[model samples]
Target: MARALDVKRLSLVRLALTSAVIVLALGGGRALAAEPERPASQPQPTPPVPAITRECQTPAGVKTAPIPLPNTLRALQQRKKIRILAIGGASTARSGPDRGGFQEVFERIIEGAIKGLDVEIVNRGVSGELVRDAKERLKVEVALTQPDMVLWQVGTSDALARVPAQEFETHVGDMVRWLRAHKVDVVLVGIQYTRSLAHDPSYQAIRRAVRRVAQREGVLRVGRYEATEALERVRQGRQPTPPDPFATTEGSYACVAQYLAQAVTLGLFARRVEPRRQRPPNPAPAPAPEMAPTPPRPLPLPPKGG
Candidate 1:
């Protein structure tokens, strides 16, 4: 009876040990299968933007603070909502509900390019006002709206009024500087060359002067003459050129306005893509070292003199 009891007891112990080993083996297999895979070495992607440096210059060759686009304008474009106040010559001012001309065309183009974007373009163009007049009226007429971007289109009237280039430059520069000081983004649209002006040396000289001022001021140029020239090229190719002597007739003006609006939309896109500046990458924290348990230290040696 004792021998039989010993055999049964040994069998029970062996069974328990086998069951525990099988469970541990199954658990180990599951853990291995569930482990996540990792790549050998992950590479970080390069940033999409190029670093931009801001700088400004004065007519007297004095350098001033870097005058880059404002962060507020960039932020607004990113949000897909931009408020634009276009103040200039007749080209910009003719878009009112009552006028129903190039302005409507520009509005349609703007709406098309920036879908779902809240864009408002207010036109305040007086028939024959020069740069000084526009600047004088801006405070009461335009500043009240507090637009994010201002398209200054006054050089045409300035040239028509025979305003000297230097005076024009000073007035325009002051207006731009003031707007910048107040954190407004200004884009200067150079004057469109008329058929009469194209042949007139004096008018051409004024156009060149306007371009110089615009460049020195760091203002974006819409290149009205180039756009008109392109349209003229297209018109020339047509066997029967239209009766209109003006390259920027109602139809041509509509086309140019559409193109300009698209250009504005692209500018807005660029603002969104790059923003004010590229932010530096955050530094990674140093990894903690794995600390192995220290072995028991040997008993301290007997006191040095002992």
Candidate 2:
């Protein structure tokens, strides 16, 4: 019986050894099949926002022309308030988001650009209006709002309407001069630039007319065309510009707002500002005539006595 028990024990121990070997083999296969151990990877750094992605993100390379926002600057200095009247054609009318449009974006940008100045922009954009219509409305609106500055978005409508370029120039010049005479500064926002219209004679002519008017008046015209074209190139991976430069995208409008804001801020702060006008000195009183009165009285009395 003892010898049988010993044989059974040896069999049981062999069975256990075989099971352990199978387990070890299976585990080794799994380890060999599994992926090898690797060094822990470092976290990837976040990429920067590209200039083309957002207008506000990039340095605008702002061209500092002499804007001389005289009244606007003066009011900002004294009253801490500056009001702007935005008058224009289609671009100004529907050139932004569905709710508030580009004017709203412009107001927020201006306010954000210049600290400690209350900037109010009133939108008086009438889509499809020519320079004549804009001028007429400007008169009434100026009388009502009495804004310190007039952001005149011109040229596009005149070009589209086939108005004579000279006539367009005349109308724009007249209004800018009128605004200046009325102590209001003018910022002429030229026509929206489109690659499609670059070759169009009428559009180019009107653009030239607007530029001439701005130059003649010595007012600031935001470089809407050039700046936007540059931005479009940057956005399109430096490819040839898109045919419709002003594709009416929210991003396009935002870029416009940024450019306009930069222009206004530079005009207000960077330019040589006009000092507050001093009152003229009072005129000197006229001198009294010298007295030969005593001698004359004596002569008259002697004649009466004789």
Candidate 3:
């Protein structure tokens, strides 16, 4: 009787399994395999921009002090143009990597930097001329061209000629004053610095004179010698600043031009002087006082005596 009971229980369990299988098949297996739906993924945030650091900067050193260019600035505003007269020292030649020397490169730079402003550069550089010669002809050039500014490359020739520092200083100072008085701005470009000449008393003296004049006159001074020397020192790391500013490339001019452009920008935005008001011509001197009364009185007295 116990063995019969066990077989009935096994048959009931098999019937339950068969019923579950039939139900799964009737549901087509799709519902049994289906999974819960998932939400879409969100996008990632954009990265922040890098701060402008000095590391990648080209190491452009501090520009020369701001020199006031009232006339130049006024001309730029009133005429939308400025004329530049470039006069060079005795050895200020037009030889450089680019066919155009500093003046040409300089002109291009100013025009490009300040949109809508035209620059007319007159290259009157007299190669091998002395400082005194340049000073003498400066007035003539001003009268002829009527430039808004004069870019004087004055010291190299004077230095080469062994001109007295006092004399050189005087010439430069005089010209600077005269130019300013005439409503023309002047920028002095110093002598070229080289290693061999670094220790030379004459060259160094001339360089000092140029500096003094620039400071005294309150005009822009392009430190060609000083800048080139510093740059070469940086380039040849661990090497003593060479007696030669350059190794093989004629690239000093390009660098000078770049520095000059920096200085020009500084000068342009410097203190804005109101355009000078023109004074009306004085009224013609009152007609010379008539002497007729005195003459008539003398004639009458002579007739009465007769």
Candidate 4:
């Protein structure tokens, strides 16, 4: 009797398993495997960002103080355009990894950074030109182009030529003042830094002079020396390399351009304090007309009666 009960239970279990398999094979398998229906996702749109806000961010190893660019800002606001005259020595030359040159690269960056604004870069860079010579040429160029801003990359050649730092400062300061008088903005690009020349007095003096002039004149100054030194520090940390005395590389050029762009962007947004016009000392009240002596009137009346 126990054996019969065990066989009956085994038969019942087999029948149940067989039934489940048959049901799945028929249609339940398809139902279990099917994915639940879901609503289709709509594409999301990207928000537009202003060029000034987006591209004006300072990059690593670059820093600059904001200095007002009243003329350039006015040009941008009124004409939607800003003309830049890039004048300097060999560093400002049209030599870069990209044939477009660093000034061209600078132009592109400025235009991209400032939305709906056109940038015209007039490259007046002369290789081996000293600061004085460039200053003279700069005047002619300014007259011809009438640029809203003058990007002057100076001090490098002057320092190499051992020009007196005081003289360098005077010339730079004069040019900056002249540009301001002409309603043009000026940015002073300081001497390039190299490890070999880091301690050289003449080179360092010129660098200091550049800073002094920038401070006195209250114009934007791009401290290329600081920017390059910062880059050198970063590179040194990654892989120490022998210092090159004449280290004018395309990489450094691009890096300097980035520094310049940051300075220019900051300047563009700086507060403009217009110089107060001295109202001509209120014209001294014109002296009252001297009254012809009353005697003269009496004499005329007596003559008419006679």
Candidate 5:
């Protein structure tokens, strides 16, 4: 009786396990049958968004002629560094990197545009200085710094002082030639524009003088006057209220920096235009080779004796 009872308990446990297995198997089959098959959907790739570059943000009037900067380019290529000497009046006053200015903006633009390039800007700006004053200081600074390039923002103070246009031209032109002689490249940043000075004779004269010098010297010139004028016009059109002088001033500086970056980058890649050589006149086409006279073929044997 005891053996039979033990056998019965064993049989009951086995039956319970078997039923549990069958139930689980059925449930699993039902789950599989109830759920419909799904095809995996492939993800579509996203297109890259176009970057808004400084050039894209630049105003239409912010124009610059791409004069090649052989010295600066050479320095960049050799040392992976560009040491720029910035000298000017109020517009170019030295500022710390935290304080934004054209110099800082310029450095950022250039470094971002180029990989593995380092830019060091030495600012030597003195406010309320005339061309003569800055020129004197520039000579000293150039000697000490030995920079690869010189960024000279000029003409505003001289214009305000009512300096004679010819005198202004002479001072700037002389300094440019001197810098070139010293193997230092120069980019002339022209005067800042304002509604008050838009028609001022002295200011206009000074601006023209700078232009003439840049054209004659063949260096890059950032037309701050033109760019600012354009920006002002746009502002005037959009807003009826009086324009904010401070905002305009900031925009002017940003535009100047962008224009400078554009000019410098273009100059770096600009190829020197080699003067066309007098290609020797093609030697008169070799005299036509003389062909021996073809012996007169006897008339087809008179048509085979016709």
Candidate 6:
């Protein structure tokens, strides 16, 4: 009976030792897992940023950089002087009884607008000429001047001559293309309405066609038709019958001439008054007094333990 009791006690002791070993192993595994997780939760240090450098250098013996020339200044230096050549058809070529032709009025207006710039204006107007006729004489009338810009006022006689829209477009397009190829800028003038065709379907059609061609070709267009219509309204109120082109009266050809001159001049003036770009000023240098060294600060007190 004593030997049975000793064997049972030994079995209980062995079970207790096995359970202790299992608890120690589980606790040690948990500590190892927690150590790895703690490191993951901590933040990493940030890298240092690089400094930016400037390309342009400061002037010699000076801290501040010299101011750069403005775009407008640079552009002005490179700009070619503009020379304009005015070419008119029919009415534009005529100096009404008041001696104010489209050319004269336009020239005066443009001249007034460009103050310091060199500008030259020329007038080559011919009465009773069609597009075909103008094209034939273009070399002598326009190309000879070697103008930088050409103000072409045609299509009135062409419309009156019953020229087909296609043919008229062809002539104008060819003329413009040729001028552009030679580096000449162009502005197209639309046909003005006369008393005969003021309300005519064909007149409206002609004006529409000209407007489309001007837009498609990227040419500047003058609204001569609208101007004439306005003038007609004013004249109708003042006169019994529309004054003849050759007649000199208050509401006659003289008035029309004055209007044409003003319109053309204003148009040219507007083109000359375009805004220009300016450059930024250089930053001022630091003052000599500001560059002096700062005074030293008082030192902090030692910690209690130290």
Per-structure clash totals for the candidates: 0, 0, 3, 0, 0, 0
TM-score of each: 0.59, 0.65, 0.65, 0.66, 0.68, 0.53
Off by over 4 Å in 5: 1-59, 91-100, 237-247, 278-306
Which candidate comes out best when scored by lDDT? 5
C-alpha local distance difference test of each model: 0.63, 0.74, 0.75, 0.77, 0.79, 0.57
- lDDT tens string, model 5, 173-292? 999999999999999988877777778898899999999999999998988788777766666655554353323444456666777887888787777898999989888777888999
Using TM-score as the measure, which candidate wins?
Answer: 5
Per-residue C-alpha lDDT of model 1 across residues 50-111, encoded as one tens digit per residue: 21111111122211222344533464546757767777766344433436445566766666
Q: How many residue pairs in model 3 have overlapping backbones?
A: 3
Q: Which of candidates 2 and 6 is the stronger one according to TM-score? A: 2
Ranking of models by lDDT: 5, 4, 3, 2, 1, 6
Order by TM-score, highest first: 5, 4, 2, 3, 1, 6
lDDT per residue as tens, model 4, 165-270 = 9988888888888889999999888887888789999999999999998888888888878876866665565455644565455666676676677678777776
Q: Give the TM-score of candidate 3.
A: 0.65
Least accurate 10 contiguous residues by lDDT in model 4: 46-55
lDDT of 4 at 167: 89
Off by over 4 Å in 3: 1-62, 90-97, 237-250, 272-306
Better of 3 and 4 by lDDT: 4
Error of 6 at 47 (Å): 55
TM-score of 5: 0.68
lDDT of 2 by residue, 1-306 (tens): 999999999999999999878877777556655858788987433222112225534455536375667788778878878898888755443422354556677777677555655778888877788988777778999999999999887888888888999888888889888999999999987787787788999888998887788788889887666666666655666454444545555666677677677667767765475788999988888788876655544444455557
